[model samples]
Target: MAVSRPTILIPSFNTGPLLLETVEAALATGYPVRVVIDGSTDGSETLLEDLTATDNQLRVHILPQNQGKGAAVLFGLEKSLEDGFTHALAMDADGQHPADSVTAFLELSSRHPEAAIFGRPVFDDSAPALRVNGRKISNFWANLETLGWGIDDSLFGMRLYPIRKLIETLEETRFARRFDFDPEVAVRLAWKGVPIVNLPTPVRYIDPEDGGVSQFRYLRDNTLLTWMHFRLMIGFLIRSPWLGMRGENPLLHLSPPAR
Candidate 1:
C-alpha cells in the first residue's frame, strides 16, 4: 500500500473559480487533502460539497461566516492534528502553485521527515508586472528587517509547515492573517529554530482565461506588512549583532528538489 500521506489543507474564501483545479492539484499529491471554506457566500461551498461526496480522500469544512485566512488555516491544522498527521502543506487556491512541482516538495519531506520545505518561487513572464516588482520591494524590506538573514522570496505563499510547532506558534502569536502570514510565519519559525529549506520552484500566474481571480488588496495588505516589519526592525535593532550573527538560507546552495 502507498504510505499514508500527510493531509493537505487549503483555506479558501470566494475561491470558487480556482477551487476545482487547486483541490485536484492537492489530491494529485497522492495524499489525503481537505479544503476549509471560510464563510464563502458564493457557490464554492456547494461545489466543494459535491467534490467531497465522490472522493474518500477529500473532505470539506464549511463555516457560516468569513473569518480571515489565518482562522481558516488554523481550523484545518487542528483537524490534521486530531487525525494524527505530522505535517500539513498549504497552497493557495489560485493556480500560482505548480501541481507538478508538488511531488518534488513532498519527496523532500518524505526524506528529511523533519525540515520545513519552503517554496522560493521562480516567476514566469505571465506574472503581473506590478505585483512582481512590488513583491521584490517586500522581499528587500523583509531581508533588511531581519538584518540580511537571506530569505530567498519572502512573499511566496507556498510553504510546508511543521504541524506541532505551527500550532503552538499560532496559539501564542497574533498577526499571521492576510498577506502578512507568509513572511511572519517563516521568520517566526526561524526564530524558534525550525530550519528553512528553500527550493527553487517555478511559479505560474494563470491569466483570466485560465480562471484567475486575485483578491489581494494591495494597499491594505502592504500597509499591514509595513507595520509588521516596523516591529521586526525594532526587535532587530535591540538584538542586532545577535540576529545578524544567526545563520539563514544555508540550504540555498543545494539544488534539491523544488518546493
Candidate 2:
C-alpha cells in the first residue's frame, strides 16, 4: 500500500512578499497544500486568491478579523480534519524556517504518524543573540512542566501536526493563542501521550533592511507564556501520573551541568 500523503497548512498574517516562497517550497515537495489568511488587510489575500485560482492543489481559507496565529492554526486544523486530511505541516510565512526541512518533516510525519514532528532549528549567525538565549529559559520551564518530557525547543514554528489529535486538544483547552501558542501546544501535546520527534533544520533571521518585520514582544509575550505554563501546570497536576511514568530522560533527571 502507498504511504498516506499529508497536507501542509501555512498561516499567513501580513505576509505577502514572502508568502509565495513558503508556498513554492511546500509545493516543491509534491504534498497537498493550503493557506489560511488570518485577516490580513495587505493586498496579500488577492495573492492567495490568485495562487489558489491556478493551482488545483492549492486552497486558501480566510478569516474576517486578525485573530492571532494560534487562532488561524486552530481554524486550519478544524478544516483539515473536516476535509479528511490526516496530517498538516504548519509553517510561518516569514521565511524564517527552511523549506528543505519542511519536506523532511513531512517525511518524518509519515513514519511516525502518531507523533508530532518538530523542527529543532540549526540557527545561523543572523539569529538574534538575545532570542537565542531567551529560549533556554523557556526550555527549562517546559522541561519542568513535563517533568522532563524531552522537548528540545518549544518555540520552533515549523512542525508537523496530526489533525485529529490537535483538534481534540484545541477543543479541550483554550490557552493556546498569540506567542504563547507554540510552547503551550508543544508541551501539552507531549503531556497527552503524543510522542514528539525532533529534526534539526536551519533557521534564518533576516535583517529588516531585507524586508523583515518581526512581531515578537519580549515582555508581553513572556508574561503570556508564564500564565500559559501556570495553566499547564494545573493540568499537569491532574495528569501527573501519566507525565511521570511517560518516560525518563537522563538529562532531565541528572543535575544541572557544572557552571
Candidate 3:
C-alpha cells in the first residue's frame, strides 16, 4: 500500500515580493509545494516561473483571471488529488503563518488523516487588535453552526484538509470562494461529521513596511461572511436531528495544543 503524501498549497493574488519569501519558507519544509497564481498582474507570474524553473519540488499553476482565494485553493486541491496527494495544507502567501510549524501539522495529519487540522493561532503583539477581536464574532458563529463543535479561530488560513473530503465539500457549494473560505469550510466539514484537530501555532503579523500585503476587504468580505453564516444557520437547523444521532463526536477526541 502507498503512503499518503501531503502538499502545501499557497493561493496568492498580487502579493508582490512577499510571495517569494512565503514560497521559500514553504519549500524549506521539504514538502511538495504548489502555488496557484490567481491572475496576479503584479509580475508574480514571472517571479514564480523563475523559481519553479530552478526548484523541482515547486510547481506553479497560473489562472487566466483573478479568481477569489477559495477558487484558487480549489484549483490547487484538484491538482493535488490528481498528483496522488491525500492532503493539502492551505497557507496564505502574506507571510503571516509560521512556516516552521509545517512539519508538525503534516505529522498530525499523517496520524489522523480523516480530520481537518486547524492552526489555532498564537498571535504576537504585531497582530492587529481589531483583526484579532473581529475574528471572535466569526468563531462564535462557527461554534453555533457546528453545535459547539469548538473552532478556536475561524479566520485563520493555515489548515490541513483531507483532499478528497475538502474537494467534495467545496463542490457542494458555490460560496466560500473568497475570504469566507476558512470559516465556511470548517463549519461544513463539521456538518459532514469530519473530525477536527486544533494545534496552537505562533503567528506573526508583518507590517506593511516589512513587505506584507493583505487582500481582505472589510466591507465586502464582512458582508459575505455575515451572509455565509446566515445560510449555515439554516443548514445547521436542517441537519441538527441527524447530527444529534451520531454517537461519537470526533471533536471530543482531541484537545487543542497548549499555548
Candidate 4:
C-alpha cells in the first residue's frame, strides 16, 4: 500500500546548536518537516528561518512565548493537518532521538496507518541512571491506567502520531500541554482504542560539550507527571465500563477525523 510521507514535527525551546543538527538529520529522510519554535530565546529562530528560506520542504512556526512541549507539538500537528498531512513523526530538538530510525518508523506507520508508532528507546551508557529509573515509575502508572494496553515507553518523545486521532485525543483535555505530553497522550490514545506499535530505536544522551542541551527539570517535570497520572487515574476509573466494552472491539471507540 502506498502511504503518504509524514511531516516531521519537532518542538524546540532554547536548544542551541543541537536543534540545527536535529533538523538537518530529519530533513535527510526526504520527508516534509515542520518545526514549532516554542518561544526560543537562544537565537535558534534566526537559524531556523534561514534554513526554511533555503528549503521548501522545511517550514517553521514560532510561538510568541514559551508555552510547553505539548502546546508546540499541537501547533505543528494542527498546521500539518491543515496542509493535508495525515501523520506526523515527533522527535525532540535535543538530538537524543535517533535520526537513523526515521525511515523505519515512517515505514511502519505507513503500513499500519491506523496505529501510533512509538519508539521503544534502547538507551546507551550515556543515559543517566536517575532519569532511566525514574521513567520506570511513570511507565508503571501508565500501564495501570491503560490496563496493560502495551505502551513500551511512556516518556520517550520519539513517535509517529496519526494526526487526526492525536488531535482528537488531545482536545479532550488541556492538561497534556507540558512535560506530561508523552505519557498522557499515550494513555489517552489507548483509552480511545488506538492500536500501539512499539519499535526499538537506540537513544543517546549527548554531553553538553557536544552541543547537547537538556530542558528537563527533574523536580518540576516529575511533579507535573505525578499530577498528570493522578488525573488520568480518575479518568480511567470513570471510563472503565466503556473501556471494558471497547476491549472486545479495539476499533470501537476511535474518534472521527477532525473536520
Full ranking by TM-score: 3, 4, 2, 1
Runs of candidate 3 with Cα error greater than 4 angstroms are 257-259
C-alpha root-mean-square deviation, each candidate: 3.2, 3.6, 1.6, 5.0
What digit string (tens of lDDT, one per residue) describes model 3 on residues 66-94?
98999999999999889999999999998
TM-score, one value per model: 0.89, 0.91, 0.96, 0.93
lDDT of 1 by residue, 212-244 (tens): 877789789888888988876676677667765
Q: Best lDDT goes to which candidate?
A: 3
**Residue pairs whose backbone atoms clash in candidate 1:** none
Position 187, candidate 3: lDDT? 94
Per-residue error for 204 in candidate 4, Å, reads 0.7
TM-score of 3: 0.96
Model 1 TM-score?
A: 0.89
Flag regions of model 1 displaced more than 4 Å: 1-5, 239-259
Candidate 4 per-residue lDDT, tens place, 1-259, comes to 2366589999999998889899999998889999999999988877777778899999999999999999999999999999989999999999999789999888878777888988888888999999888899999999888887777789999999999999999899987999999999999999988888788888999988878888999899988998999999999999988887776324323322211
Clashing pairs in 2: none
Global lDDT of each model?
0.76, 0.79, 0.88, 0.87
Ranking by lDDT: 3, 4, 2, 1
Best candidate, TM-score = 3
